[model samples]
Target: MTIISVYYTAKMTDADHKELLEARLADIRRVGDTVNLLTVIEEGFESNAVRSKNERNFSKEVNPYVRKSAVVGATGMMKVTVASLKMFSKREIQEFDNETSATAWLRDELEVKA
Candidate 1:
């Protein structure tokens, strides 16, 4: 499994966010198939219409490479965003309060699937 942190993208401009998304997509593709532990743990990580559209597209693009997925630091309204992503991607993305719990869950899930 790989842990990809995109929390730094919190509060970024739309253009910057799109650029980072492209970079992250490249990284994910390089890593190939695995359980992806995505950390979106940042206070200002809110999404707008444009960001939401980018994210939906991202979810689809990464769907083939991501064997399983989990996220941490999705508090308040971010939970809604994650839920929306989950539905759009048709991927069961489990949420955790912190990185430790999320990583552990991903590990356990991988073992079960194995």
Candidate 2:
């Protein structure tokens, strides 16, 4: 299994989200291993449209292939939205205020599966 960690430094557009996710998924397919995703959203989404689109895309298309995910650095509405989306994800999904806690949660999820 591999943990794919992505650190976001700037606001993410819809295309940026797709590109990053697809790149990671391609690597997972090539490696043929379970992947735990850790996304650190430092700057948030570019717009409400971008956030909604990405959320829909992730919940419908990308989440099934993921084993677990921990989203870090989300606060305010972002945190609330992410937390609410948990029902749409088949894999374990959680939000955190910091990378250390998010990474720890992902590791714990992996260990539990192991």
Candidate 3:
């Protein structure tokens, strides 16, 4: 499983934000396989308390830090939050309220039935 470990913090800049996203996308490209994007976030919501963010919005408000994933073309994450959901197509959208639910759903949905 392609697993990505991440921690969501409100402290970040647009450049740093873009850089991280690009890096993650590059990593995904390197794998070219279905992997789990495991993220250990703030357990709350993406706050807009970071500097140079509000005065200069990053084109979106996905908790600048967490938003990095979406910017990296991770549609799976893009459709996670209410604001970012519009960044993707609804063809095969899957959302789970919690990690446990998501894990089971992935196993059931992505894995073929015998």
Candidate 4:
């Protein structure tokens, strides 16, 4: 599985999104595309426009490689952003208030045999 922790306090540029997507793609490739992801985002988006654009770009590129995703530490607009992303994605996307809960849910959802 691929796990990512994102913490930022400024607007993300297209290049930033591209670089992140490339990294995620590389991770997926390394895992042979059978991947679940846990993304803990802290203060990543400064505004709705930035969140929407970034998520849109991510959904286009990374969603195909993800089988499921758990988004932790999301609140307010970020919670809304995750919910909106769930609408168009074929893969499952869930939000949580903490990493523990998110990881537990992901384990259950993916039926991890560990």
TM-scores, all candidates, are 0.78, 0.73, 0.42, 0.69
Clashing pairs in 2: none
TM-score, ranked from best to worst:
1, 2, 4, 3
- State, as a TM-score between 0 and 1, how close model 1 is to the true structure: 0.78
Tell me the spans in candidate 4 whose CA falls farther than 4 Å from its real position.
1-18, 43-45, 48-51, 109-114
Candidate 1's error at 74, in angstroms? 1.9
For each candidate in the order shown, give its overall lDDT on alpha carbons. 0.71, 0.69, 0.39, 0.67
Instruction: Indicate whether candidate 2 or candidate 4 has the larger lDDT.
Output: 2
Clashing pairs in 1: none
- Cα displacement (angstroms), candidate 4, residue 45, comes to 4.8
Query: In candidate 3, what are the lDDT values of residues 30-114, reduced to their tens digit?
Result: 6665544443333332434352243123223222222122112222223344234335422122443455544544444443222
Number of the predicted model whose TM-score against the real structure is largest: 1
Better of 2 and 4 by TM-score: 2
Off by over 4 Å in 1: 88-90, 109-114
The deviation in Å at residue 108 for candidate 1 is 2.4
Tens-place lDDT per residue, model 2, 1-114, is 578876655665667777876676676566566788887877644336665666566556556567888888776666766776776667888777678877877787434331
After superposing candidate 2 on the true structure, give the runs of residues whose Cα lies further than 4 Å from its correct spot. 11-14, 44-47, 109-114
Measured on C-alpha atoms, candidate 1 has an lDDT of: 0.71
